[model samples]
Structure formats: C-alpha cells, structure tokens
Target: MPLILDALCLARDDAPVRRLIDALGTEPVETTERRIGEPAVLSQHLLFGSGGEIVLHDDAVVAVILHLAPTPSAPRGLDAAEWLPGVDNDATFADFKATFDVPWRFADGDRYFVLEAAYLRPEFVKHGGRRAGDLQRVAFTVDDPRETCRPADEDCPVCRELIVRTGDGSFDLDGTVDALVAGVEAGVLKESSGAVSLADLRLLHASALMERVESQVTCTACGRVACLTLYRDAPPTFGYHPLDAAMRRPLEAIPPVEEWGDAARIAEVRDAMRYVDHEPGLWFLVEQHGDLYLDSRYTISSMADDSCLIRLDEAERQEYHEAGRDSLTELARRIDRSGPHREASPFHRRNLLRHPDEGRDYSAEVRAAIAGHTWLARQKQAAAQRAQAGSAADG
Candidate 1:
C-alpha cells in the first residue's frame, strides 16, 4: 500500500526542513535528481529509511510519498499518520481507493492513503508563508460588549443597564467606564446591589496591559520579529513589514535635503548608518585630527600622513569615536560628494576639482550635491522625452 501526502506548500527555508527531519527521526538516506511534467521541470527526491520520499522544487517541499504494507497483518514499517495527523490508520484497500479516487488498477494488497494539502497548506499560505508554526497574537474588536459578556453573571444587571443607557453594548475602554461610573452615581444602575462596580471593571481593564495577550517570536534566519495575526473581521489577517523602498531606489532618486527638510535628512543619515557595516552601497569617510577614517561594508580603515592604510580594530573604532570627531557631518559631506558621480571613479581629478574646505557647511554641501544630482537626473529625463517625441514624429 502507498500513501501520498500532496501539496505541502512548505517554505523554501531550513526551519521547516529541519522540523521535518526531526519529526521523521532519520536523515535522508539518498537523494536523486528527477524530472517531471511535459516541460521537464527538475526536482530533487529525498528517500528516507522509512520508505518515505519527499519531493522538492526550488527548495520547497511539495509532496511526501510513503509506502505501507497490506492491512490485516498490522501494516509493517513507519506510520504516516503519526507525523501527519488526520490520516486513517485502519483503512482497507477498497476504502483507500474510494476515498482518494485512485484511478489506476490495483491488486487486493495495493491500498493507498492520500492526505490532501487542504488540511495544512492553506494556514501556511495565510500567514505569509513564514516558518513560524502558528499565530502568537489574536485580537478582535466587537460592536457589542454584551456579545462577549456573560449573561448569567452578577454583572448582568450593570451590563443590561449599560446597553440601555449607551443605546448599544459597544464600548470604548477609555470613556465607557467613566460614563458607566457616572450613571451608577446618578442611581441609574445599581452598583451596590451585587453588580460588578464600574471601578473594578476599570481596574481589570488597566491590568490587562500587563497580561500576556500576545507573544513574539524572532526568526532565526532574518533575526526579525515574526509576522503578527490580527482579527478585524470573521477571518483573521496576518501582516509583514513593507518592502524596503529606500534600498530599491537608486541613490540619485532619494530626495534632496532641501526637499525633505533637516529632520528627514537626519533620519536618512541615521538609517544609513545602521547598514554601514553590512550594506555595500553605503560608505562613510570621516576626517579627525588630520587622520582620515574610511568605513565600508568590508573593512574600516584609517589613513594618516596622506598614506598607509591601517585597518581599525574594535578598540580603535571606540577610540576614534571618543576623540570628538564630526563623523556625522563628514558622512553627510561624503554622501553629497558621491551623489553626482556615483558611477565614476572617486579619485577622478574632475571629482576632486573642488577643494575639501571649499564648503564650510557639510549639510549645505550635501544639499548642493543632492541638488546637482537632481538637476542631472532631470536633464537626462528631458533628453529621453525629446528623443521619444522625435521617434513618435518619425513614425
């Protein structure tokens, strides 16, 4: 008998793979390249000791196929249902065929158990295909407080009174309690007659902030907080951080300091600083006490006496910062300097034609460089438009 687990839809990450391997309790015995479909798409098939096989395409586990012995003899080898639940353990050959709609002709012993992907795949895809097992936080806002409150409880009197006075059971945690308290004081609701006081409810609501209503799990691969689940309607929703727009844009496309203002420029500089050690596109050159400190993705080096590149260690980096040098200002200046001629050589004589001390304000210089880059970009855009217009006229 054979068991087919279809449409796993597992992410192309190591987390799920590692979990699968652990659950199986054995490493893959052999791996072989297999081709399928009319177009002959390549896939990797991993064979396990338990007669279970996993098919992978683009590192995503798409299917798992396992072979089981005939029933009545207690079916030898691994049990697929133990790892993947909801599979029938005591199904007959006829039952398997009828359940899975197996089209092929088979002998009495050739039974098949098919575990459909619908049981697992939909939830995985719903949560942004993240390897995190399940949602940590699930919250919802209701239109009626009575919908969530117990009707038989001691607070029922107050709850009913609230529904009548407020015109509906809907609540605003901040303002509703005060209104309820006021109503009780005005003798509209009985607060002392075994009803839960509005003050106690207010205290309980405030204490909820300290309770663990949600959990956060950091992804081991990206070291980022995993996706969150929110319920705004009947079906739940999951969200991920928006794509990195700044990284996607070319450096020239970044708005100039004058357009973005001082606060925005400062924010950009700070954000870029975080990636200085990891982003190849970002670099910084700082001058401190006649020594030039060059920081890039690969290495942090210092140059003194206009020669001799010395790599800085952790201690040297700390000392450099403690020496009271204007690194931020210098970084802004360098960004300004590189904006116009990013593709050209940094040491090109034309690039260095303006002396380093020509601009006293580094922020102003950065603004000027950004302005120049913007002007050049506009000029190229205008030139492209003119060429396009000429082509249209010719056509």
Candidate 2:
C-alpha cells in the first residue's frame, strides 16, 4: 500500500486556510494539548479522523498537517467532545501587521514615515500607533541657496580662479592638472598632490562648489532623529542620475492595510512584482545557423515557445562521451572546462559542449530555462501594457 501526504502552513485567519478547511468540510474529531521535550514547546491541535491535524502555535493558527495512506497506523483515539471549541482571535502580531503596510515595513526606531519611490507620507508618526493616515500635501522646490563657508580673506586665489573659470556656467571640468590644483587648494582633495587623480573627483562636482542642504526631523513620540536630505548645484558628469526623481516626484502615501483588504493587497503585490527580474536556469542561448538554440550540455533544444526537446547532435555527443573517458569514469575531471580540454572559442554553438554537466535530470535543465524565459517575457509585456493604460488614464 502507498500513501500520499501533504501539509500547508498558514496564518490563522488567512483566506486560503479558511477556504481549505471549508473545502474539506468534515468536522475535526479531537482537539488536544500537545507538548514536546522537557521544558516543552506546547500547543493545541485538532486531530481529524481523515488523518489531518490543525496545529495552533501560541494562540495563532500556524500549520495544517495531513497524512494519508492505504493502510497506516491510526492517530490517538478521537475522544474529545468539541473540535477547536474555543480559539483566541485577538493575536495580530506586529510583524504580520507590518507586512500589509509598506510604511511599517521600513520603519525603524520610533519614527513611522515612508520615503520610498512610490509613496511619500511626510507625516512622521502613525496615527497614535493605530493606523497610517493620508499623505500631507507639502509642496517645496529645490534650489541651491548658494551658501558656502569661505576664508575671511576676500581674495582667495583658488576660489577666485574657480569662479572666474566657471563664470561661463560650465561645471564639466575633468580632474586634469588645472582641476587638481583647484581641488587641492579648496581642501576637497584630502590626499597629497601625487596620490589623488581623476578617479578621486568622480563623486564631486567638476567645479567642486555644489550647495547641499540637510535637515533632521525628530520623532514626536520617542524623540528619535531622522534626516531629510537634499542636494543642489551638482553638474551632470555624463547624463542625469535616475535617483534625481526621488526629490522631483511627489510621493504618494500608502494607506493602512485594513483599508486595502485582499483585492487591493493583491494589486499592490502584482504591481511590485513587475520590477523583479528572476534569473533563468544556467544554460547558454546559442545561435546555430540563423536560429537561436538553448543548450544545457546534456541536451540541446530550440528557442521557440512550443519546440520539442532535442538531445545534443551526434558529433557533440561523441565529444561528451570521449571527454568523459571511454567508460565515463573520468567525468568530473573533464567537466572543468578551464583546462586543456577547453573549447577554442566560446561564441560558437558547438563550443557549448565544453559546459559542465549541471547535475540535472536529462533535458530538465532546458525545460526549466524555457519555462522561466517564457514567464519573464510575459511579465515584461504585461508591465508595459499596464504602464500604457496608466499613461492613457493620466492623459
């Protein structure tokens, strides 16, 4: 006799857990207090006649364990009068609450403000620690206030030279001989004349006198401090930094989870997942003739959405057998493509035979790679469609 067993762990009030229980329909037989070890990790669990158990950890429902077999030892006698007769419902852990609220996810210490790319709730505190409120509409602009601490002497040659040269409003000086001299005299270049070069000035503005402002906010409840940082008067080294939008865009506020419910939470999760780029299984995308092919050393396959599995060609298959020695005994030694057995050129599709065996079951590697590639392409297309829809709505 053979048996199939499956178990799923979930939060007490999770929707899926409720759905599974409702689907099973059968009433649990006995609810008992179970303990483990000497000091004992203790919990209450429900044992059903169907060989299923619902384990509750610390008043919060955690795991639903199920065991099924054609013939198996019976669980302890189902003698209890009621199944989960009394369950405590008031155990909402802080970590669980934080999962639904994005602001709470990043909050550290006593402050509760969100400053991420999507949402910007400037309010520094959760509403008396109950729930997050709407974003305060605070509008401000960034401009260099043009304040710099200078030596009391009005005619500092370095400052005068920099201002004169940059009078034409160009901050595009590479840290060459002239730039180095200005940096050294202005005390921005800490290392001696010989040590620092063009690389050292990579982070600094070329003209070197960029104005910046920094402000700190204290948490209303615990008096903890957080900084509100802004930059100004910086020249573009090559092109614009994508991070500049952090200041430019008005940050929206994430509402409390209780307000979002399941539907809205799923929407948020789906939106967030668009930004993730999962790595496909390790396999080379090779070009054979004019068509793209995927090979995982053990097997070769096509790049089409519905192509069937194909094993390595006869010549390459012979290489795999010969390189592994006549009996395949020296397999590991030959699999290391770094040594004398290495292929002459990596670009050629035939050179894919030099790749090490990835411990996959036959053509399973190619199958998984194709599946992942297909899924990634679908995700990108869907994200683009959503972006287009959003732009049209805004227009």
Candidate 3:
C-alpha cells in the first residue's frame, strides 16, 4: 500500500509534505505520521541569564520566537509573571512541558519547534504492561535540570540541596568566602576523614551562601504587616520565635540565635524550608539531590564566580513571599483565558469545546492544565490567607 492510506492522515499542504518527506527520507512514520503522541521533542526559547546555573533537559534549548496569535487580547509581549497561580515546575514543567505547551521566553532569531521528551509516557506505560487499575503517571515537560541535563522520571534531592546550598542555604548567610582555604584547614576545620587536607574543604565551600535574618510579610489585602524573627527549625520556630503569635504580644524572647551555633542552627532552618507549603513561585524544585542542590531552569552551582546571600532585613522576606504569592495568583488568571481555546479532534475523549474537524491539537491539554493550575492556586492562596487572617484576628 502507498503512504497516506491509514485513515488518520491529518490535512496538509503539498509543499510542506514534500519538505517533510525529504527530511524523513523513506521512513514509514516520518512519511506518514498521524498520532498525537509521536516521538518528538517539544522545544521553546528562554532568556538565558548571564549568571547562575541553568541546565535544560536535553541541552536542546532553542529560541521561542512567539508571534502573537493576532488578536486584540493576544499577549503582546512575554510576561510569564502575569499568569497567576502558576503550575508547580514538576506537574506541568516536569514531563509535561513540550512543544505542545506554551513557552515562557523566546530567542531573538529563530522560530521554535517541538521534539520528544526522549522518553514518552505512552511508550513507558505501554512497556509496563496492561494493569489498568494502577494510577497512570504521564510526564509532560520535564524541569530544566542543571546536572542531569536530560529528563528522567526520578528525583535528585542532592541536586535540590546543591542549588539551595549554592544559592544561600537560608537567610543566615555569613558573607560567602572562598577563603582561599579548605573548609577543613587553611580555614579552621577538619574533614570527617580527618585525613583530608584543609585545601580539599575549600572545594566544597565553593558554593554560594546566604544568612538567616529577621523578616516579615505584609498582607496585600488588609495592608497589615507582621513582624517576626527568622528561626532555625519550624515555621513556628521561626515566626513565633518570640512566642508572640501564641501570646499575641511581643515580650522577652525565649531562645535566641546567639545561643545556637550559627552553622548548625542555619542547617536546621534550611532543612525546614524544603517543607514550607507557601504560595508557589515561578522558580521551583524540578529535581532534588539529597536536600542540597535543587535543579531548576534558573538555578545553578556550576560556575567560577562568587556572590554573597545578602542578609535580608525584616521587609525583604515579606516582600519576597508577597511577590511569590502574586506570581502564583496571577498565574491563576491565565487559566481563565484557556477556556476559549479549541480542542483536538471530535474523536478525542473528554474534550469540552466544539470540534473544528481539523484534527487533534493542544487545546484540550493546555486548557486542562490551566484549569487545574487555577484550582490548585486558589485553594492554596485561600488557605494561606485564612491562616494569616485568623492569626491577625486573634491578636
């Protein structure tokens, strides 16, 4: 049988077909691709920073020159922050970010394209065999990784901690110093092995550092500001350090930062950050490496430069968290716009909008993602607000 007779031939122009045919040569799938889940890599563009770590999933970073869809409301420029209640990097970004999904940034010259995830969920699940009862897990776009440099269905907490450590373990940063000495000796400490020289410790100290300090977050709604000292262990340990939230009054503080060794105390506080479920932010943990380096698009530990984690004053952390909430809340608004999009084919299940007969497309998938993002963001934001409101009311 000749090519294009399988009944799933999506409409196409003759010129494009000739080009595609030339590119694929004589391969069967190449000459006659039809399925939505074809093996292909979905790529987009991003603004590569001049500093910090950014390791894309396949090093296949292409420029995303997005031409506005040509409508009044069509976004004129790239402003990812405008989207509220953003998706956690893992769910939408993790195996789901593909050519099908939207790009956050674009390159200057080239029009972008999409390719495969290297590992497709359909192929993965199919290989595992017919156990339908199991909750199916499918990856869309994977988090841009720094170390691995490719998408894999696993977690690396080491990477997470590494990013954190390199960035600023916490607010408790003592100005970062290469010390020109090893963490073991040329500086002042010895290795666990005791045999390792001080020079070797210097290698480990090469990462970035930040110190823990007092901070507060102001309410965007009520304009009420909450003052609190940062703590080493729990949110309670940090926020209620003076134990004031409990008493609803400031008083003689209990244990103070000086009582505890800065290094040990800082470690505990840093560890606690991994658990805080604050309103999500644009940058997040895509890969974790033993609570150390957190791999993400803009995170990195691989470099020659050095910078100190500026000790944030009371107002900084508050501002940081507030900005984060706004970022997430805005992402929530993007979902509302998705409902207007078209869907794949009439044959596709769970499709809500009218079919265009043109064939399967990204409408349904993007819409579903946006809707889910909106719901989750609102739930989290509401819960946070209620907690803060309850606290304020009690005081």
Candidate 4:
C-alpha cells in the first residue's frame, strides 16, 4: 500500500525538491483561476519551522507555496477554508474569533487554526532547550476577539488587550496559531506526505536558509523599506544590492519563535523579507555609498527570469539619482555621448542638435563635415528621383 504524503515547495525556484515533488506524484502543476484571463495560481508550498505562532495567531511562520509544472504560475491565493469549516460561519478575523473547543487543534498557538489534533512526540524547542514536555498534542486558533473586546478608550486591535492586528491588517491573536488548527480540523491543512523527519528539520534549520544583501534602502516618504531588484545595468559594478525597504530591525513586539539555527541569521532574513512586498515580479533599488544596485534575486515568482524587470518606487528613483547621477538630463547626455555618439562621423552626428547661438560646444570640422554629408546625401536622393521620373516619361 502507498503511504499518504504531504506537499510543500522545495526550493520554489527552478528546482522543486525532487522528493517533495515526487511525493505529489510528479503531477504537472495544475493552475486554477477564479476568473478567466486572470493569472492561474500554483499551490506547491515550501514549509519551514514548526507551523504556528507563539501568541497564538497573527501569521509569523514563513511558508511559501508556488507553481511547479506548466512553467511556473502565480498562486491562486484562495484556500478551502475561508474560516474554519470552509470560510462561511467563521468569526471575523477583522474583529471576529473562532473557537478551538476541546479535541481542537493546537490551541496554545494557532488561529483560524487548522488541525483539531496532532502530536509531535518528544518535542524540543527550535534550539536545544527546556523540553516543552513530550510534545504531546496541542490546539490553537484565531479566537474571536468579540468576547475579549470591550469599550476601552482605544478599542482597536492594537490597543485591545486580547486582540492584535495581523500582517494582513486584521485584528487577531499575535500570530495565525489559530488559523493552522482551523485548516487541519476543516480538512484543508493536510500533513506533508514527504514529511521531513525531526532529525532532518534540525539539520536543515542549522544551514543558512537564504542569501542576504549587505546593503538596502528605504522610502523616505512612506517609511517603507525597499528590497533588492535586478537590472542589466546597476551600480556597484553592475550587480544587485539590498534596498532599504528590505532592511528590518529587531521586532520588539512580534512574538519570537524558539527554533534552531543561528537566530541572528533568521532574524536578519526575516527583517529583509518583512519590508519586501513579496508580490510576484516585484524588484527594488539598492542604495549604498553614492551607488545604486539591483538584486537579481528570485523571490516568490513562479518563473523568475534571471533577467527580470522591476517596478520602481520613489525611494529607488532617488537612490539612482544620487548614486548613478542619473536624472533625465544626465541620462540623455549619456545616451547621446556614450551609446550613439561615440564617433564624430557625419553619419552619426547624433539626434540632439546643439544650437550655435546657445554656445554649446561643438567641433567646427565635425559640423562642417556633417553639413557637407547632408547636402551630398540629399542631392543623391533627389537625382535618383529625377532619373526615375525621366525613365517613366520615356517609357
């Protein structure tokens, strides 16, 4: 008999984890669009760390699902359970909460939480630390803040005692601890088929999960950080650099996960990702020491062409202006001088004409040569036209 398997994104780049993909039976990615002509979504997910948050639910665990077959597609963004039990009666995450009554999912840390029951035996903290007990089963979910909500000076999620706003900007527990439990109970959160064993988890966790950009930039207007973007021509010798928006400082408020590995690196990467919009096909400008850089990183794209185009925000424009000295006028000058005006030949006199009255410098010899060439070329064309006309008349 075949064993049941769980699915997840292995690399989410060009290569999917062979074992993980194989567990899915190597099915070519199947895309479904909610509407026609809209991009279809791929759902191959790459899961890391124990899935859940500490304060119960706000969505902290970083897991990514992507498209695999038929050449990489965007995610559909729809899940089976809108709320526990398929999204119908679920309490409002904006202000509602779902219950994790007993026999419920990991209650301690989950929301809209999925599984009703699961036990990872002999559970140890991400780091080798105080055993949080035999990892006996647990339940968690995004409980409704209604009961917890009371008329206080500030009734907002941030100010409310039990309610906290989620990354998606809804009031809920700290993380989506509740959501995971809800998915499991609702039969949406299936276990990974090629489930990584506990030992494997620790080993992989120790390794660096991703690459880091030493440099980054910030949007002065929005106070949003910009992640790295890729371009054929960028600064710092034409390579990618970290954008300030991608930079993150220690988040004092969000609950911390006690997973294994150098917490420092995880923290660093997490900070970078937080500022990154992570929308498909997005790129940001990197600013460093009077130079602007584009990072050719493949983040969240189904098919990340090594040569990808990026959307720029104001911060990036300023960085390029400061570093590359690239304003409209400067760019025009460079294009004319470096790209199309390298030779002084009359044929290549350049498109932008300098006005003699303006006293813009120009070579007298080059100018005279160009004038002569223009006269000669025009006469040749005119003579050809006259000869053609004469031949027609004779015929």
Candidate 5:
C-alpha cells in the first residue's frame, strides 16, 4: 500500500509545484504524459523515489498536483485512495506523524504554503477466491504533534462533586427543574404551572443562568471551558462545548494566535483585536488532546478572561470542526482576478468556489449572530418606538 497527499494547486503559475518537488527532495525517475476529454485533458505523471510519483492533471487549462506513493514499502507514504492500499491494522497516523520528520513545509520567496496532512489505511473484504481492498481515511489534517502532552486524570472539585452526586447514572432532573423555576422568579422565563421541560429552557440556559444543572464552566486552574451536558449512560462528564450565536461574530473577527498557555499571553495580544465583546467566548478543545482551550480571543484582562462565559450554540456546532481557518484568504487564492480568469470555464469556477463559496456570505452570518445581542435588541426596540410615533403623527 502507498500513501497519497493531494493539495489543490493554488498558484497561477507552476511555482508551487516546483517548490513542492524541491521540498520533497526527489526528481522524476519516469515521466508518463497523457491527454483526455473534449478540450483535451492534459496530464503528466512524474515518478520519483522508487514508487513515489507526482501527477499533474490539467483540464488543458487549470491543473492540480497530486503526490502519491503507490507501494506500501515506499518510504513516508500514506494510504489515501485507491492508488495506494495499506492494511487496516498498518501504521496509524500518530505512528507516522511521530517518526516522519521531513520538511513538509514549503515556501516560495515570501509566500508560505501549508499542506494539511491526511493519513489513510486500506479496508479489505474477501471475495470467493480473491481479496480486495479500498483506501479509507483514518485521520485527516493531523498536526505535527507535541509528544510530551498528557491529560490530567483528576477533574476539578466542582466537576468531581457533580460526578459524585450523579454517580447513579442519571441526569439531575430535579436540579434542572429548580434552575427553570429560578429563571421564572428572575423574570427571565414565563410563569408556568405545569412541569417545565429541558427543551423549553435551552435559551434561558444559554442566556441568563450560568450556574445551572446543565451549564458551561471554565476551569480556573487549567483554563478549560466545558459544558455540563445531560448524560444518562454514564456519570456526568463534560463534552465538546458549542458557541452561542451572540458570541460567534466576536469570535470570527479575532485574529488567530499560537497556542497560549496562561492569561498573560491573551493580555499581550489583546489590543490588536478587532472584535471585543464582553459576553463569554466559545470553548475550544485542543487538537488531538484531552485538555480544553477556551477561545478567549482579544480578552484584555485576566479577570475578563476568567469571568467571560461561553454559551454553546448546539444548532450550528458539529464534530470534526476546523477552527481558526481564514476562509477569505482561501477564497482570494482560488479566484484569479488577473490572467485568463474570465476565459476559464464554468467547471473551473465551481472548483474554485467549492470550499469557500457558502463561507463568502460569512459577513451576513456574523451580522445575524450579533442580531440577538443586548445592544442590537435595544436598537431594534428604539426603532420600533420611533416607527410607532411616526405613524401616530401621520394619523
């Protein structure tokens, strides 16, 4: 089985291709040239380092560079697709990432190209007399991991207490009920005689009440923000938290920073922030690690960092989420304002808009996210009152 790495060809010229080839430290051992399709599909297969090859496929117009290692014995190969097949129990992503110390990073002059690594293994099924296998991705975009990282086994006192109280493997319904009743008392919820459901109090839990049965909290010691989600199967444990709508716009504007350890790092880089909302930020889990990292973007003070609460927006949040990706940067790279962009076919346009298409309307999303904030709510109220006054004057 071989490994494959496929990156969307970003550059207008062949500079990125040449840089990648140079970085991999291999030259073409065998070159196979072919063309297909109505407009002639021009492609070149350049074999390198025993079984490794770089395939440059063009629509005779735009091209994509594919890196492949077609044999299992080939060094530093991933079983990505049908071309490269590996056993299901072969080397895992962590195993490869731990040892493969090649310079995967490529830079042409000032421009740096970051390649997201994907590791795959082949899954096999036995036919009547023959065995067949297909490549299945086991891991995608695995980071260059830091080996020393380990999870702390002990939970904080609050979490430990919650686990103890709910050790019978049942959700704390009584506590949830009490929290709802309190919301009514605090004028945050409508008065109801009948029993209140958890479903009805989702917004209340996301907004007014912080310390509730199913609530979110950030650990002071480790700076991990976790949501106390309702679980029936096991003792109450915090799962991956979600970002509330109100906090999403603020999060989107904050610039990406390297992993910060303490509050001081946030303070240092705080002033350069574009969006600085007082409400709690989103909880972010560290990639491939058990520890939770709060998205305390542009938090000026350590006090604000600790005080800020995160409301998990369950509607939009999904698993396998990629954080800190600048979609506009990707959009700009794909769309060519110069050169033969106007002459490019509709097929090429679709390819360019694939990832960043829906993401382009992100400003609208940001505006919608902040639409429910207190300031916006007040503004809407004022506008409504002014409209009423104008109608009265006309009458």
Candidate 6:
C-alpha cells in the first residue's frame, strides 16, 4: 500500500508547473492530455513521474499528488503525522500556493491533513491513487476578512476590536484571532470555529455587530458600512409625520418638468403645476389654473371636464398618428379652439386607462399616492375643525 498526499490549489499561471517539476525533483515519465469528469467534461493535463502525479487545467494546479515509497524494514505505509508538518511550513506552503494561484487570499494558509478512504474512488484516480486508505487531503482558500480589509480614514470600533495590525503593516493573525475570541467572549461577535465556511463566519460576525449600532457606521479598517440596528433597548421616541404628496410620488410616475432650451426650465414648469396624479399606466399633471395634461402612454392629451380637448403638442399628435391610432388623431384634430372649457374632472372619480404592454405592478405607487391624498385631506379637515371651534367660541 502506498501513502498519498493530495493538495488542491489555485495557480496564477502555468509557471507553477515548472515550480512543481523542480520541487518534485523528478522528470515526467509520461505526459498526456485527458478530458476528465462526466456531464461537464474538463480538459486537464496529467503528468506521471516517479515522485507522483500532477493535474493541471486553466492555469490552476487542480491537484498535486505525492506518492511515498514503502521501505521493507518499516511499516507498509509512511507515517501520516510525520509528513503533515512538512507541508504546513512557510517554504512548503508558499510553493503549494504558487501551483494553485486561484485568485483568492487565503487566511492562515496552513495545510490540514485528514485520512479518508474516498481518495481511492475511481472519479479521483486521475490525480493519482492506490488501494490504500492512508490518504491525506488538504485545501487552501483566500476567504478571510483580515486578508481582504484595507486601511480606512476613520477606524470602525468593531473592526479595530477584531483586527490587529503588525509592525510590517501586515495583519497579525494570532493577535487578530485573540481579538476575535475576546469579541465572542464579550458578546459583541458570534462564536464560530472548525469546519464553518468562511462566508458563513463573516455573516455571523456582521449580524452580531449590526444588532448593537443605531446609525450607519463605516469601518475605518475595511471601509464596510453597517446600517441595520436589529436590537434596541426601547422603541424610538418621535412623532411620525407623513411626507407630502409630491415627495411621496414614485419616480416612475413623475414626468420630467423641463422646457427644452431654457436654463431654469424644470423649475419654471414645476412652479406652474399644482400637483400630479397617477394610476396604473397613466399619469396627469394638473396646472395651477386646473387644466390637465394627461399621458395615456399612447397619447399625450390636454383635457377638461372629462373631455379630451386637444393633443398637447405636434410631437404628441405625430406619435398617435404613427401608432395607427386614427380615432385619437381625429379627436385631436376635431377639438374646437373655442373661448371657454369646463373644469377638469376629479382625479379620483375619473376612469383610469392602462397601456397594452405595461405589465409592471403599480399597486405600491397607487397606494403611496392614496396615502398622500388621505394625509392631505386629514390636514384640511383638522384646520376646518379648528377654525369652526374658534368661531363658535367668539360668538
């Protein structure tokens, strides 16, 4: 039985191929291009030599398999514990990292060995294998926050409490670990250890910290913003005032209030309008004088008293004509440019129109608009009640 050590790593390029060849101290006896895997085939290079086998693909050293020769005088397989320390060292780990430059910043880039029988499976045989259960596997990853954090303008208390900086400007891993342990002990960060995915670990820490802070605070160390405060001693104490109708209107419902060539075009147009109302796929702007400019998606019409008086502009008329809407074009043409017209219909009472292709849900926008209207109505009723009470008292 032969003992095998399989190391999976990311490589920056094929440069690690040459490095591995040097480290192994053996020339390849056989080299072949092989497509491995089923359903999704992967193109890989298989190199067989006296040392072991190397699998390479897309500038990544998918696996580096080492075969330990058995000695007649010793046990059938090499000692797994003895070989584990050799790969964990800086010199060995750096070479391992070079072979698999997987564009990740690994935290505590140490090799951990686990003995398993699954290494003998036929699927993993391309990376080199034998019938022996004395197989060790190691994985490297760049998913640590300490590896990703950058210096910030203002230090975040949470980050400062978690990360520790060394004299060389690199993170002090041991110190950082100590800080993390302290955070957990103090109930400021969640406890995570052994086998937990790096992403999950980071999330646990984030969720724990967010429960303590109220306002948005940016971490000076990593430049991450924490805004959600999940836990509070008591509910916020403040009067809740509703926003104005204009402020509450959805951005999609608001038209661009600008004249084509004027500097203060938007301001001028906005100043002249009383308010805008929207329903589903249609919206209208009501002028200060009560005249309505409506956009039905298909036509831009100027209306009063439930009647379509005229098209607002030549562009609008052309649009309707181009769309083959003959009735709307004819209606725009027949409108009498006479002296007086009736007042525009109340927005709430009018029958709303919809566009053929507009499938989006405008219920939220409609609800927001209704809330604004209700708030305004309540304000007016309150003022009237106040005035009537004052009049009765005076009489």
Q: What is the C-alpha lDDT of each candidate?
A: 0.34, 0.31, 0.24, 0.26, 0.31, 0.33
Off by over 4 Å in 2: 1-306, 314-363, 367-375
Tens digit of per-residue lDDT, candidate 3, span 1-395: 01211101212234433333333232222111111101212221121121101112222321111111121222232122221124211222222334235332111111111223321121112232234322122221222211112221112221111111134333221221222122223323222111112222222222212122232222222222223232233231111111112122332222322343356654543433231122343312211123211111111134421111112234434554578545433432332233222233211222212232356433343233233244435645654565465445334
RMSD of each: 24.0, 27.6, 27.6, 28.3, 27.8, 25.4
List model 6 lDDT by residue over 1-395, tens digit each: 11222233445234545555644444555554532211112334333343345555444554444444432222232233343343321223343334433232211111222223212111112232233432333322122222222111112355433445478645453464456556546655432111122223233233343222222223333334222221324321101111121122122211232312134544544545343553332333233343344433322245532222221356644654476445343333333222112223222222222221255333333333244344445645664564455345334
Q: How do all models score by TM-score?
A: 0.22, 0.16, 0.15, 0.17, 0.20, 0.19
Residue lDDT tens for model 1, 1-395: 11233224554346656566545445776776643211223457665666455666556665554433322212344564564333343433333335455232211111112132321111111322133322111111111111111111111233322211123533233453454456546654332211123433333223332221111122222222212121223221111111121111122122332333346544554433121221123434433333443432221233311111123335556655776335434443443444423345342222322333454443333333234334434545654564455345334
The segments of candidate 1 whose C-alpha lies over 4 angstroms from its true place after superposition are: 1-7, 70-76, 84-90, 93-395
Clashing pairs in 1: none
User: Which tens-of-lDDT digit does each residue in 1-395 have in candidate 5?
Assistant: 21224332332135555554554345765665643211223445554544334544461112222233244334544334333233232433333333343222211101111233432211122111022222222221222111100011022332222221235544454564465445435544432111112343343333323233244333333322333343223333333121221111122111132332235544443422122232223322111122111121222244542111122223222321343233222222223232212345222333222223545532333333333353344534654564455345334
Q: After superposition on all CA atoms, how large is the RMSD of candidate 4?
A: 28.3
The lowest-lDDT stretch of 10 consecutive residues in candidate 6 is 237-246
Question: Which candidate, 2 or 3, has the higher TM-score?
Answer: 2
lDDT (tens digit, per residue) of candidate 2 on 1-395: 00101223344456654554544344556666643211223455655565445555444444443332111322432211122112111112232234324332222212222223222112212333333322211111011111111111112233222211244544424322355445545554322111112332323222233343222222222222222222345332211111111123232222332343355544543433121122233233323233333332321224321112223455544664466323222222232232322244232323323332454342444343344345435545654564455445334
Candidate 6 residue spans exceeding 4 A from truth: 1-13, 37-41, 48-50, 69-83, 86-395
State the local distance difference test value for candidate 1. 0.34
Candidate 3 Cα errors over 4 Å, as ranges: 1-117, 121-130, 140-158, 164-395
Shift in Å, residue 173, candidate 1? 72
Clashes of each: 0, 0, 71, 70, 6, 11
